[model samples]
Target chain A: MIKQISKPPLAIDDSAVDATLVKRVQGGDVRALGDLYARYSVMVQKAVVRTMPRISDADREDLVHDVFLSLLKLVNKFDRARVFRPWLYGVAIKKTQNFRRKRSVRALLLRQRATNSEDNPVHPPADGQLENAEIMEKGLSSLPAGQKDVLILHAVEGFKGEEIAEILEIEINTVWSRLHRARKTMLQLLENEREEPGGHENGV
Target chain B: MVCKYLYKYLDGRLDWEDRRLFEDHLAHCPACLQQTSDWQQILTVAASLDNKDVGARVAPPSSLDVQRFETMARKRIEHLGRLSFLGRPLAVAIAAAVLLGIAIGVWKNEAPDTPHVAAPAAVSSRVAPHKSDTSGAPSQSLSEAPLVSPSATDVHFDTKVKELTGSETLHASAHNGQCAHMGPDTLCLFPKSRAEVMVSDKAHVVALQSGSAVFYVQPNETREFRVTTPLGTVVVVGTRFSVTVTPEHMLQVVVKKGTVRVEGDNEAAMVQKGAVARIVSEKSGIVTRLATWDELAAFSVLSKMIEEVPAKPLHLKSAKKPVVHDAHQLQDTAQAQSLKMLDTWRKEMIAGDVDGAIEGLLRYLQAHPNDVDARFLLATCHKRKGHPKEALALYQQLAQHQTLSVANRAAYLAGDVCIKQLSNPQCALQYFTPFLDHSGRDAPQRGEALYYKAEALLQLGQKKEATQILESVVHTFGRTGIGQRARNRLREIQP
Candidate 1:
């Protein structure tokens, strides 16, 4: 037999720890919920900030709290066979979507439905950020809803096509197409803004 | 310039061979290379956007917020309660019962030895009248009490805070004197009083801005009832008391039923029951003394402010504008100004203006004859003015007609007049018997009632029974002045 070089056993599986914590949470141990919050609060908060960049600090913090509350209330409904991180990540995304949906309704009520990102009065870009990032943020707001979701999941969340497909419950091909459309639209909008300032307000 | 596999390659849907083909195509096509470079910049933007400190854009973390979250989650879990064996209808019923049980438990824990003492604000006239215990049954002792809160007449604290986090700081102010029953007891504010009252799991604090406030604090081991003033602070572990800031910059703390510590000007003193503490200018330190008759008379009605719960629902006849139909708010605030009348009378009584105060009460009683507290205060002023017949008449009427606490007090006062003023020992026995045979430890004036009962017994020539009762008072309250007087009485009778 070939010489078997023994390597240290692989690092402990995080899922096992998560499973134990989840079991404790299901058994109504709120301390376990606290533990889960301590572990993943920063991650959930990061996802919220990235998704809603112009969100006020209070709104983002409340959104993070809402995500954890949903997890605390619905931990029993979680499928144990799956990984906890992505499931929580999925929870984070869904809650953010729900929040955005409500925010959109409020915006509509105020008659501030802005088709152009730069013209949007409800969420203005704050001072002191990368110039290119601000332009990208404006351009991203102009993209179609489906393409924007897929693009954020792929590029920002660092999920591959298959994972994005799983998280968003879309076909792999659909994820590819939407992201392609998102890039094309973003690039065109950025170019128009550079060439002619007010010409991009009409939207793609 | 547009390549078919460009997005597939960008989104990682392309195989290695296809990626190789795409790279080959990119190498050949200058237009596609520019397009790919532009797309890469967007990807870079997305990559750098991940976890940017963004701290400036968000609120900082707070431990209090975390605690509130934990409390809210606990309440949510209470909502998501479990039921396995019971059927659906029974489960619903059981769940409702469980919620009610939790509410009652919270009520009992907050109000340990106290009974429901008054009626709700809306219908006190129809409700409280029927509850007057005119039946001649002997009052049961506290140990044997069922520990039941008479639910029908009282506004349950649990229901008031069911929709809230139950830890909010209530900011209450009154241009005129206003009385409100919060939690287990009532807080009555003197005219022009302003206070921030916060009763929470963490602490019970009343930050007094101006005027005087009386607190009948529920006994709690975890937190002290603190009244902070500009001159000094009065701290009570758990008791009923009052705090006033004098215009001369002296802080007066009067303790009716508990010990309080007064702190100011780098001086502090512990004030016990039936005493007062004066926090004067820095040089005098804090002086503790037995409450004078005037101070006691002024603050005594405040401790009994709990009886004011249904005294009036507060209709401000002073409202300048007409009704808006849903003038519930108007009603609540309207009656707050009316309490200024009582405050005026109270000030007059303290200043030895008994006739003026009695006239004010007579006027107020004409419009609202059923007001128990005003009527009782009127009787007290009559006694102070040496009108024993008038005081006795009012006290007997209130004893037979008023609610539990005021009625108990009336009976005790009636007994006092018979012994000290009228010297009618037989009349004293009728009034003193009800107060003496009381089972509950919450019975007010128990020591004095017992002492006077002994005096009445001796007057009737029951010397042996009188001696035994006097001995018991000396044994129980030896540290108090009443106990010293009982010892003196005991010695004179035995020899």
Candidate 2:
């Protein structure tokens, strides 16, 4: 029997094109692989930027590389039966999370050494010279990864709750709850920012 | 309670029933509307931030980085190509043992009869098998008959070769065949029941017109070579393998060392060492099995002596040119340059520089118009660059070369482009029909091909025929993705 239908079936735009490209890549068609990379590298970059807001250019590039490398090696294992974008999103998320974990371990080591590193452990505090974009990035960074993922995918990336849930491998109801809580937390943070000394009005 | 519908409505994910209920509630609700308005502002901010991150902040990997990665990947792929034989080490060891055993057996019995004389370049004449006539050879005739005339297309061999003619009147009469010596390698012909073979002077390729032969390719041969038969093609870099066509029209390949890829009909399979691949008549399918007597003669002393000598390590010529060359270094240089050009084209294509690759390929094709491989590459570039009309034109040209290795896949891709990109399903049918007709029943994309044809038929207002095709797909490929797609289409039509 068909499982419960998600609110929006994850339909990637130009999915047939993606399928053809995938088949060609499987056949070792280098041009098709290059086209696949050209088409989706931007999406992968966006995912890293949002999911990992404060990452360095090098780290971000590394994460992007890892995502594509994983795609290249493991593409044969991908179920062509399913949509490609959701699977790709899953890879991006997992790679970013792995990077985050590695960074945390290094941060812990630095802390033990009492190293005065400029970069924060995870999410750095908003400094005095924060612009609107930086402040917004800081706000998204403050939320838990799950909530950040839901909010960005839903409100930012324009994916539906069901599609987000599929990418995150969660329930639609869970996606809604995460979204609601994320918004609540965002409002509270903005309110707190407004009341801070020398702080400007909340950007949002 | 209204919050659920509110979230869905804001996200634009609310179903009809939930949307109607939410609207009815919104008509009477003030507090919810104010809350939604506040939420809308936050959402807009979030959307803007995402847009800014993508448009201004997030940066894709630099082209330099991509080129580095592509370079590394290309090296890795090339390494993998060279190491393909390593995947079946045990098979190789076992095949080597069995082959050695057969060789030793033949040598023990036949050693005393033949003289230990090195072969001459032109041994076309057959002498009676007697030790008194010319030293100690008993089974094979010594060279005495006049040399057979060389073909017009024959290359300038370092040494002359004797062509053979079997007696048409003698049934199963023994016609002793001499091994053709080319550099360090040897080509032995063991034709059974009216087999004809052609040996190339360069020793890089052989054509079997109507029989079986054993090729003991020297390991020093760096470039991959091919043995073409009427029924199949066996490609290998360096290996000991035999290609034979059975009376039943099955093309059989037995790999005794390294690995060989057999391409015939609509399929191709890699026959590793000790493995036998039988291409059924008409290239319907390939059947792989363990090596048996059919692969090589049970007793052949000459075959045994070949394995007794260790293979020389291949010394590749240069980094720029990897092909191993003989004394005819000029020919090798030209071939190597062509290969290097193809590699450059591949790298360009993979870097998303289709325009550059297309220009290069077009120019290259002008000089080599009969190079179907270049045209195929060009067709793929067009397909990837969203030029369906150009891709179709090239594919149509390629489809005509039925003997080309990638013709089936090229035809299928052409049809796929037609149905998916061009919206010319009627045109797709022309290619799809031929592809389906040629493809075996168990071909992987048969179901998808059928579904595509069915969709085209439906688009042409042939619903009844389309439905029937869908039913066939659902019944035949019931659990596959194509089957599921067909089922979904059937549901839409039936409902």
Candidate 3:
């Protein structure tokens, strides 16, 4: 494993690094695959969590590797004119979507809730935060699929309207409309939870 | 009353008139104003998934997860890569072209990548001047050919050292664009140039297989230093010289100091200091002349190489070996320093304090689980402490290590313990398989892997498999000490 050492701050563009690594990977350079994984894994993992909140840890881990494996075979289709991060995230989202669609009903029903909270690097949903996290998961899952995607890409991933538009491959106006409706529905869900008699909700 | 423009306004998408209407409504409508605050709060909670102010709700993949993903992904790529490369129509055509090229070379009575050693007496006479015999050199044109290893056995160091078989280099990198150090020899490579260096008891060999490199070899009487190009070999006792493979793939040797025997085809040229030797196949024989300014410019990096060995270590060893202390006791004051404590623990091990060493090693591994050397030492401590199972487990973990030598060593040690300590030959086979799987034919542990695998096979009542493996050991590595042992075993088994 290449330990990421703390180094002198250099103004290196990430896009250039990604482009170089992608080209090298397309040429069958394995180290570049490792490098490309190292750079974007954290972002992809976060996206995985937001995309598939209920995915079993083992399944999630497999899903993550599957995304990269798909990239290894499919990256040739990535346009040089497009940015790599959005392209890679697009791959991750599609893999997750496919994983969701293909997994058996019995498997979904038997999905194990993670017991090793200590091992989880994610901030555990605790106290009032637990309700919000649950609500976020429930609310997002309940939304129209397109609206849910736009909301997650905008609010959770912190992508701009333009980047989300490019990633979702939709018009910028469609992204805004979806994001608007998604946020409104989610806000209504949270407000109803807050107003339900027991009202000492944690402020934003 | 619900305001339709509230969310759009938050998104910075509302037009000027719409923004006015939204603010105009919010000015009097407390319900809409409070609703906007609620939306802001909810979005804050949502954004907290990514925001660092509140701990990020979604953690990225852990380092271990990243490692697993990398390993699995690389395996998939490798599997597909092999299939794709072989599956290509172009691959077949290229292979045929290469075969045809080799056939033509053989038809023309030329040997490629084979340098004949010159006896000292005939070294001068046998090498006819410019118009003479050039026998061993490859007659095929290398003008468009990519530089590759001469062969598996006599392979040179290239940038792809990670996957390359054998212990070829101590350290290799294009440091500051030119010079790279391999032990005492400093190789200053021309930009984008390639070379391979191997140091062993018998020979210090370098294949300047492509581009050019200025080699400064410090003289050692015990070993012969030989540099090979695709076209020829330059044997020197001690020398500062530059070897270049030109665009036409001709061998150009410029010697700045000492004498070098340059051999190409069947001809040899004894190039002295300040001389240049050119070997353009047997037809051109060997030409000697004064070095040009450009040929001498290759030595400019020699001044860069003049710096002393670094006074301080630039980085800590990733796998630090425990240092044994002879007399001094480990102080409690220094116990807080885990790595130093590791040294004291090592001293304790040497002093037969097995429990103390185990205790310290366990603690050390708890802190630095990835340190394979420390883990190996801990395994040794465990084995000495008579816990074969514990030691075996640690060695099994160590076998997965990325360092080729360490992985091979771990597998070999694990197999030995399984057979000798635990008397489990089947388990021994399990451990030995990794050594064989990862080791290339030229890999240092390839012989040991085979030898141990054969031993396990024999113990498992698979004499046929054992015999075949033993025969392979004899056939593939018959020159080595392991081969001799394998041959002796074969004799006992057959007779």
Candidate 4:
């Protein structure tokens, strides 16, 4: 007879070093807060770049700096026991979202101006060094925000679904479902491109 | 049972009982067996897509940018320091003036018979209970204290006291001070004298204070090491190998060359070429073992490549060759009948008639109660129809038998069903624990048993316990998909 399978166990424990550093920062040690920022800035930057590629390099650095400064303001309210990586990523995700929205507005305005003009029409910036990056940016922008967030956090950032849930304040199952859907959609999009003549030439 | 546990089986999330039931069903039910093959194909497709590069790229931060950012950070800290000292006094002055104005108002409003207006003492006492008890009293005195002890006098006394205690504490802790930070592909080593160990969600700190010690760190992993000996603090990256310390407070190191470096006492050495170094207490060290490859590879964390070794080839002996019999005469009647039953059930299942399939299998089992095939097929049908509880009961029955091959399969299926379908990790544990308990050396399912057991542990929130099980699987199975999965899960949990 086919035997009934059982589910695996789940474990939870507070990370001690994370807890200590977070506690110190919350306790008003600016140096501890700075140390925390220095530690996670690269990871946060990578996650942001994956999501917000269109942002200028200078602007990306500024965004990263602003995230730390914003985090500094809220350090006193952050929970010491909770893992800080996901929380910081969540903040970075929000910052990236804000940056995208501002860019979108600017693009919309530019399009409107081009449409109103009789002779001059605004063209998109040449692909240049960011051609592949632009395609990825466009693909990500096309995804639903929730799905995009889950995909970036899980696939690109190498976080587990459970960690993504903690960062996004969602259920673990939600993370899984979003990841599944996002992967399916990305596959479908890639397949569509593959069917087009010369699409493979673009090195996706 | 097979149907019920299919999802769990596919996800590799099944507990023991369900996994057993699913396997039992698969052994007997050809239709469910085919379904598993289809599921495997789907997984292959999914994995391929996941591995495909989608053009998300990253360029490393330029060295120039790092320099500029560090300079800016230093300036910001200096500016904040100046602001903090100057801002605090102005804040206190404003607070004092507000308090004085309030006190004047209260004195002016006091009636002839009013009970002394309590001289702000009763008001302060009443407010103390409402505010934070720790900081409330000190803040209340901010206005009163500055009037008695001017800011300059208090600042001088505070500085003197701080200098006396800070210098002593600094010297005591300075010996073992080491700080290390790890990013995705970079390990940053700071001076041991100024380093303080702090571990966050993305980083780890290990204090290695002995004169010599060996540490084996695995790749895609980061560990902060603090060394207090004369040669300085050494930070290493990647896994596999050990470090040994000498009695003279020098570090003798050997690395299989993932990445290793010694930083301290105004000197740094990058130990490449799988070399060994004898770092003297005060002098720059010499690196040896450069002629031949370092022996540290053996000590390195075994890679996932180890698990890929195929099962040992089945041995065939000539001495006990089977006597040939006529095909019709040799076929066991019971076995033939069971085969016919499986055929009919498979046809019914293929026709999309699950009830017919289940009924046929159940009758076959009723006639031959010990017919393992029929029993397993029935359980699988029930499982596919979403009857996990029933599948569990059936798989549990077969898993207890002395038949090693059949029992092991049943146990694995049972674990799968419990984990995937019902999402009951606890129930899954019941089935998986036994399989692990009984698996012997060289059993094909032994590695699988440990892996599933760990999965069950993980689902149940017993992470540390699960980590031990996963570690065992990695040690045993090495390069197999199961071992790779275990390693991946370990990374997820460790940091």
In terms of lDDT, which candidate is strongest? 3
The per-prediction CA RMSD against the true structure, in angstroms, equals 38.1, 24.6, 29.6, 28.5
Best by DockQ: 3
Per-model DockQ: 0.06, 0.08, 0.10, 0.05
Candidate 3 structure quality by residue, lDDT tens digits, B176-208: 224454444445443334455565544556554
Model 1, B1-495: lDDT tens digits are 327777777777775446556755553342354456567657655444432333234343333454466566666666766422111111010000000000000000111132222211211121111111211221122113211222212222111211112333332232334545444433554433345455544344555543344443333323334555544556543334555434342456666443444565454454555577766553456677765434444443332233333432323344332222123432332243245466567657744578988977887798679987688779878986889889999989987863555566677879988988889888888998886664245233577778888888999999999999899989887865457667778777776
**Which ranges of candidate 3 are over 4 A from the true structure?**
A1-13, A49-51, A105-145, A183-204, B1-40, B48-68, B83-495
Q: Give the range of the ten consecutive residues with the poorest summed lDDT in model 1 chain A.
A: A1-10
* lDDT of candidate model 2 versus the reference: 0.54
Write one digit per residue (lDDT tens) for candidate 2, span B121-169: 1222222222121223421221221011111112121222333333111
Arrange candidates, best TM-score first.
Answer: 4, 2, 3, 1
Instruction: Give the runs in model 4 whose Cα sits over 4 Å from its true position.
Output: A1-15, A27-39, A102-148, A166-173, A182-204, B1-211, B214-226, B234-495
Q: Which residue runs does candidate 2 get wrong by more than 4 Å?
A: A1-12, A49-54, A100-145, A184-204, B1-4, B15-37, B48-56, B61-72, B79-495
lDDT of 4: 0.46
Model 2's CAPRI class? incorrect
lDDT of 2 at B4: 55
Candidate topping TM-score: 4
Worst 10 residues of 4 chain B by lDDT: B98-107
For every candidate, the chain B TM-score is: 0.35, 0.35, 0.31, 0.35
Report, for every candidate in turn, its global Cα lDDT versus the true structure: 0.55, 0.54, 0.56, 0.46
